[model samples]
Target: MSTPAALRALLDGRWSDLRERTRRQLGVVELPPHGLDRERHREHVLRQLRVLASAGHPSTGFPVRFGGGGDLGGSVVSFEMLGFGDLSLMVKSGVQWGLFGGAVQALGTERHHERYLREIIELDLLGCFAMTESGHGSDVQHLRTTATYDAAAGEFVVHTPEPSARKDYIGNAARDGQVAVVFAQLVTDGGEHGVHALVVPIREPDGSPCAGVSIEDCGEKAGLNGVDNGRLSFDNVRVPREALLDRYGHVAEDGTYSSPVDGANKRFFTMLGTLVRGRISVAGGALSAAKKALTIAVRHGETRRQFTRPGGGEEVPILDYLVHQRRLLPALATTYALHFAQEELVSTLHEVLGGESDVDDRRQRELESRAAGLKAVATWHTTRTIQECREACGGAGYLAENQLPQLKADTDVFTTFEGDNTVLLQLVAKGLLTGYRDHVGDLDALGMARFVATQFVGVVIERTAARPLIERLVGAVSGDDLHDRGWQLKLFEDREEHVLDGLVRRLRAAGDGDAFEVFNDAQDHVLRAARVHVERIVLEAFVAAIDRCPDTEAAELLERVCDLHVLSAIEADAAWFLGHGRLTPARAKSVTGAVNRLCKLLRPHAATLVEAFAVPTEWITAPIAQR
Candidate 1:
């Protein structure tokens, strides 16, 4: 593929420098050899975590004020790149920094961070995020762990009341971890408060198990075996009441509980919602895996010939086939989409942390909404594209040596972790609804400006007639004619609004009866809606990137990528077009034709598209590459 001079120039500057530095740091660490055996896989993961610690990759994100080598964005950036190395290592690093350390930073009071953040960051004290339990996975509120206040002893007695109450599938729990940031129900005289975090010391400094803390290894599982997954139970384990890590809720000396956030249930959701960072991290890792796989598969297809050229005399690369291009190129496009979205997400997160915006109720809600939407779409797309990339590589994809099989296995867990895809999609659904409610009433006066606004345009699209005419006019064009650039642009723009309207209408008619249930009931429709919304955002981002492109050729290639991506995604959902009367039969057929033609057009540059991501080679040492 050709380089867009603009993108290459940007990649050469600070971004390139950062990528090199990260690659150097990550290169010093190496994961253990792969094994087809599951138990051996688990062992390999543990070994890699130790390697990661020794390389000092986990401490890069902590605040320098707390003895960390503060570079929050760079830390996450580096960690995301670790997907190029191994998914297990990336997740292990996440558990160390994003979860254990993040829990302390986001939920714990200053004292907790001062006491444990440095140690955890430095990997001197390994930890687990003990939240998911046997009875709870995505529905964290249902978890049964308890931390009953023992006023007489001035402590909290942590106990797992039943076998099901045991924390199951906790990474780093059975071994390595000396402490855990445990999530459990906080019970005080203030009544049964919803789940809150408590910092618990699970082992002595010498690594001996502490009294009342029981650990049981999960043994073996699907993917990510390098890190130990274990079950943990506490039998009246006592900790000083201050161990509650009360950043949001605190218990007073007189047994009273106080919190700045109102309503216990809301507070619980608010607290759990902070894990959006983890969700975004999962998106990053999943994308890295998908992108690496596509890069390998594309490069392999170009060099590996199985058939004669079309004219029949000489051998030709497998990628010369239109079918191969269609299969692999869209996956490459999605890789770009996910990467761009993540960069936007990371920037937003930094702004939130830097106090660029007030962390008030409104701002928090906005952050939460954006996080849910981006995470839901990005993770779901990553899994779908990873599977596609695997198939694109054919039989070789199944081989562990190529890393696709292992990459897929490790990444498959991401959709369910952080929050199950279904649950997170519903959260995004509610956010869409909430945003709709806020904006719909004001659509009348701000009608013109609605199109210009980045968000809240859906309500305007639905509440007006002008959008219908626009759709009708755009729908008149045939998808087959490659010469109609103006018409294609108009069609793309109209289709975007219609898609947003279709979703807004569906959500509005559902009328607020359990956001998750509404989304679940209309699961297929809601997901389609979210995809359209996300794709539109991504395409717009890609187009905007053209201006930022330093070279005319790279900019042109990126524009084609944006076109191919938008068309393919739109064509995939052409059913929405037919159902809504937005497109006639001929035009609907044209959508498919347009997508196919675009795929062929962009096939030559698939490699360059993935490379444009500028991911570190150290992080993405997949087996497939140009030799």
Candidate 2:
């Protein structure tokens, strides 16, 4: 089926020009053949980085004054599109331009930008983001690397006080990086300040380790070998006072630490929040990878004929089977949902980082929480969807030429990095609870009265399992239109609100108890709340995007895609809906049946859906898919 021009335009997302330019750029670039040799892969990625730099691709997000385009969202969208070709190259570019360069731009002042931004953007000086340590990946506040101020010399001496303090799994550290943005505790004569970023030279111009700096390659991993992962330990590494990325906090010449933000924890979190772009970019990249995997797998499913019917002259294509449709179509639908969610995420990121709007603290917190949750979900979705796509293609997918193995292997670490999914979910839950508390705290007399009334109703429902009554009333009014977008959204929203309400009550009841124990017991509940909230966000974003579509054939087709996403999500969580009496057992079964029906409806559009991603034929070079 030919892709509708309208749908094609929609699929280009917010950064249409940038996405098309990148797709064209990727189409023209010559990439190395897929391989297992880490060194070769590393060189291939480095070569691609040079190609990208020459093409001016890495400078999109940087300031135009610093030899960049200064298009934050466009840069990320372009980076995401690169995921279609080589994931290792995508990651390497992200490390160079997003993580390392972004840290400098977001955290540093004019002095640092003037000194390094242009060189970094041009790839003249490769760098590493030395934040994650052996002992602390997410807990930046307690890192053991210390930078002590030398008032006499106007320098800060950076040292890894213990083995665990060594920065580990630092991309570009093993091979290409000449400098690093090292995060360490800032100590002076007065007292120790919390974590601060300092630009320190790790390797000399000739690629040899600088004095007092030791580096070791992290060696082989499950995947992404093209990007050299390494560890660094500092033995009294000293950088000038001006080396500090002091956007948030700064040390005086007299060794007194001062920050616009009064508190240590606040300063640390605010600084770390600047890197939310990394998380958002990773989410977009993961979605792109999943789209590529689905494209290849679905195309193969369409062409690869399997078991012949009895006494039949020809074998039917595997995609004709219900099982195959079930495996690939729902994933395709989810890819759509993730795409829309990622678009919204990128927009929010642009607003925060693009200087287009005022980003207050609350907005920043919202953006961070949403980015963390979406990153977790999108990466986890990519990992699972790629695995399923691989299995759906059977033996053919296991081959490197098909690219599923590469996609699977590369995206596997996405969940662990940025932030661990589990920890991120907890962060989402914490944000939810904090927002809820603030809401209640700010209630006036009229609001408090309304809240009390709502709580009374909630208590009655919980005490009596009143869901059946409400279900009956709704069922009488609407019948079996549960697949309706509004119904689907209400179902998701209700579940999330209910779960949050219950979790909040439980936590409040545990007052004065062991806080850790209380949290430990409620971990599962908290995670469920986070998952439900993220699902709601994804659903709303998908529906909102669909609503914005112009009246065209593509819009009609997208409505079907949106329906599939809603039904599939509902079907996956049928047990929760049934348990809450939001869906009867019969209705729950109908949800699955509806999903199967939507799969059949979407089967014919599978090829078009994937093609709408506009991945170049060269990037998707699997033979079976090509056929």
Candidate 3:
């Protein structure tokens, strides 16, 4: 029998020490109480924020020169752990370090970092990531906010040109923030360069709004009310030229503009790519929420008795029923699969951004593409799984203290935030069509589909992890054994290739004529391609993880769990396989049968599997889950 400890060692992966420390430290502040007024809730969260900062909890991602540990992967893993605590605190911390502070560290030069990074890390200066606007949410390249260089004054005038330009849904802006990393169009002399970030003050030393700045509370949201989300507008707000975060782009005091990146579009995107950590962080946190939700639901099912057997000698545990297992077990399997995928993603991020290698453009674009796809997949999984988990617990899961309702509400906006799930998927599809052909790589959203006419040769199913092992396993398959790991791997790969081929045909047929229109027409196909591609990546990561497990019994358990995840994914998309001729009618039916059997086979181990997630005891205060 595989012990939970053995399984936890596998799930913890590279950042085991950091994960353990975060759980212990964060457990000190239990989940916030329900029904506190928004003000009280915000105040409570702020106090906790101070406590965390005082202990250097927020410095993992920053440079060592700036009072930080300079551990980028640790920063991401730590944020993921926060998902099991008060989600409001999670979001607030993300804004403070991952976004606002991240922008400064990644985009700003030494002058910017030296002047402000220490205070930002220490919580002496709370700030906002002012990117999203009322008029433009996902369309970030054409923001209406402007930072015009005033050569005579040696300053830049940050202005919100219209109502639509006002920054909306900004955490830390409604209150507590002293500054904002505002994204705006930068104009020098007479020409507009493109959108750039400037560190502009929102609050004065005494905590009053700056003279030309307007701020309004977004007010009680459906969830995360403690985050202090608000709207902001600027009216010719002036900041010194040094305020610009000038890593990829720059402006001289004489009103001259230049950038290391050649094209205006490319330069803006290169600058944005430096901050991909925010998107990756969101994906990790979303999975953490999914894990917590699944843990709660699975624990309850193990002990909560349901309808009795036919003879009525005793009521069976809900987890023993095939139906309840179907509801939670397949989802539990997916949660495990996603956890492995996320771990691989973080490591890739660490290696690429950790300065171990040169900044190759192709690798950079690939990283961004993977980040976008995983973020979309993970967040959507979180939203869907939490709802299912809530339903699994019946009435008891709805109570305030059970944590499911709060988890459901807090994570609902994840699919839309960071970047809308739909848009992110489209970006991934665009990459599949035009990316990696002849070493050409680009990630600009508008130009993403432009090269599809010449770039796409054929589908290249590159394994993201353990390539030799995966190829060996995939090569050994002789028959369509649904339980065979090789067959499952090929199945996912074949489906993804077919989806991309069909999408390519549709787009290629519209050559030289209204390309955007045709791409839009095939939007459904595009999203499906992205989804399947991500599914393939996820399976490879899971297989690679299983190969690395040291404990024999735990690896065996994970193999079955991995089977549950892949079979369930295929079963859910049975129609596609049937229509695409990849699966016979018999095999399609067997997919469902296999999923049902796996769920039943995995039922007895539900508690052990979720226990491996090692969610802190304080966070699981659900009455039904009482130990």
TM-score of each: 0.86, 0.93, 0.97
Model 3, stretches more than 4 Å misplaced? 356-358, 436-450, 460-462
lDDT of 2 at 76: 86
Clashes of 3: 0
lDDT of 3 by residue, 1-627 (tens): 357898998888899988888887886674678789999999999999988887678988889988888888889998998998889999999999999999998889899899989999999889999999999999898889999999999999999999999999999999889999999999998599989999999998988899999999999888999999999999999999999999888898798888888887677667787888989999999998998888889888888996788977788998898999999998899999999999998998888886734576777777888899999999999999999999999998898888899999999999988999899998787667775433333433224444554666777554576999889988998655888989888888888888888877777676655645766777899999999999999999999999999898898989999999988888888888888787899988888898888888888889899889998988888887776
Every model: Cα RMSD to truth: 5.9, 5.4, 1.9
The TM-score of predicted model 1 comes to: 0.86
Alpha-carbon lDDT, every model: 0.69, 0.83, 0.87
Per-residue CA lDDT of candidate 2, range 421-475, in tens?
A: 9999987877676553322224432333334334533311110123343344335
Q: Per-residue CA lDDT of candidate 1, range 1-627, in tens? A: 345434544433334555566677777766557554656665677666667667766766677787666665556666777877767678877887889888888788778888888778667778889999898887787689999997788999999999888998888787777788899998987679889989898888777779999988898667887777788899999999888879789987767888977876667766865565777777777777777777778878877787785579878788878888888887677666566656666665655553333355544555565566667777777778778778877887778777777778888878788777777665554445446343222332123123223344443212111234334535676655543433554655666556556655555566635645544566666555555555555544444454466677876776677667766776776776678776678877776787788787887777666666555555454566545
Question: What local lDDT score does residue 484 receive in model 2, on the 0 to 100 scale?
Answer: 62
In model 1, the Cα lDDT at residue 152 comes to 80
Q: Could you tell me which residue pairs clash in candidate 2? A: none
Highest-TM-score candidate: 3
